[model samples]
Target: MGRQYAVIGTGAIGGFYGACLQKAGLDVHFLLRRDYDYVKEHGLAISSTFGDFTLPQVNAYNQVENMPPCDVVLIALKTTQNHLLPHLLPPLLKPGTVVITLQNGLGVEPEIATIVGETAQVLGGLCFVCSNKIGLGQIHHLDYGQIQLGAYGNNHQPQGITPTMRQIAADFEQANIPIQLAENLLLARWKKLVWNIPYNGLSVVLDATTDAMMKDSYGYQLSEQLMREVIAGAAGYGLEIKESFIQKMLDYTMKMKPYRTSMKIDYDCHRPLEVEAMFGNPMRAAQAVGVAVPQITMLYQQLKFLDARNIAIGN
Candidate 1:
């Protein structure tokens, strides 16, 4: 039997990985809604700048009940759906099931670990992909579709995960993609957080591309400052993300020329946004460490108001 895997939320991240693994001949399933029905009729359609392929038919579900026990569960839902995990996770999990969480908010590792326990392995991931869901079973690839996963089992520890993580890394490496067992996964998460916390909000507020928004005098300085504050707060918690790390982040941002944060995409579609996923958690962390994240706090509040107003207006 092939390695059975299931992906919850067939959006860009989950859909991309599922399609890859399925194309590689592994048994993969998806939990979706009407998208599943559309995909059932139209199949999985992926069109990328690099290439395009169409899967005639792929498995998908409208609810958690339709899922079967799987060896691995990739959770890729928006951060706004974090609370829904407690109700949805139990049915699909069993002892030895690995639940890989690719969610965006901060401090979710612990919550997931607490809920899933020894029955499932909770791992964190950072996805560099900037994609959009163009249609059911169709994800429009923009750029930077790479992923890095934490090797730690839970709470940033390596216990009970060396062999499995090595296998995962090897499998991904053989798949001809950049995959690594991060030495300091927490720091990696923090670095990625620096990109999201400010950039996501900045893009939504300014309604601009990364290069257009970030290249300007004001946006550039503000983004860097917000990143510094976040890094300092991380340092207070004993995670020292060095200056070099920040420089690399800037390098990555520069490459995202026409980039728009995922939240910005959500804003454009007038759909529900994951403000708490990228913004709520970081500001909470800064407060916990006594870091004065005045700019970040201000940005978060402004975006929160906008998101809330949109939600209230039933947009």
Candidate 2:
């Protein structure tokens, strides 16, 4: 029997992965919000610079009650939904199902494991894609679609990923998305986190893009300062990423086409920013390791203030 895949929170990352799996001929179901009604009626529309195609008659569920048990659950919800886990997630797991988290942050595995179970298989994946929910059933791909996933567990001291990580990666690869299985996933998580933590927040707070921020002398300096601190925080936890490699990452993101990040999108929509997962988690980790993160801490603080003020003023 082919693996039963349930794509939870069918946003850009989940939709993209589930679409790939569906293309690969996996038994996939999308548990989405009401916006996917059109997807169920007309299937999913993926519009990319490469091309556009509609996957006709794809399965979509508006409510969890209508969903069936799945072998693997890919979770792509924003980190803002993390607190609601106890109420929203328990019923979705089968005996041996693994829930993969594609949220970019530090120290998420532990929190997810605590909610699901210590022995529950929880794979962590990093999505390097720029996409937007263009319509009810359409996802507009802007640029960059790459994935880095690995068993959050080790050969002996395992926490996430059963024996199925390789199979999952293989299935996703067959779906035509570039997917890589990493032996050391923490490095990837930290790597991705380094990019997201500062840029995403800064973009929304300042209404800037990767290039705009890099071009503006003050913003560019702030990015470097915050990123260097993040790199130090990683090393404090024994992730020895070189300064040069970190600069390369910043340069890549800076050179990307003018793109408003997820944070900027949220700010524009008046939705709550995922301040906790994207910024709070990493800054907390740095504090735990006694790594000074003054710049990031300040950014996080200001962002939190923005949210708090907005909520208070009903904006």
Model-by-model lDDT, in order?
Answer: 0.76, 0.77
On residues 217-312, what C-alpha lDDT tens digit does candidate 1 reach at each position?
898887788888779868867888887777777777887567777888888777778876677777888788787788878888889888987777
Give, for candidate 2, the lowest lDDT window spanning 10 residues.
154-163
Report the lDDT tens digits of candidate 2 across residue range 1-315.
688888878877788778767877888889877666678888888887536677887888877767777778788888887776665567677788787888777666667777778535878888888888877778887887877876765321333444577777877777777777766677677777678877888987788888889888898887888778888888877877888976897788777887788887877777788888778878888899799888889889999988777656655
Quote the lDDT for 92 in model 2: 70
Candidate 1, number of clashes: 0
TM-score of each: 0.93, 0.92
Clashing pairs in 2: none
Model 1 TM-score (2 dp): 0.93
**Candidate 1 ranges beyond 4 A from true positions:** 152-161
Q: RMSDs, each prediction?
A: 2.0, 2.5
Candidate 1 overall lDDT versus native: 0.76
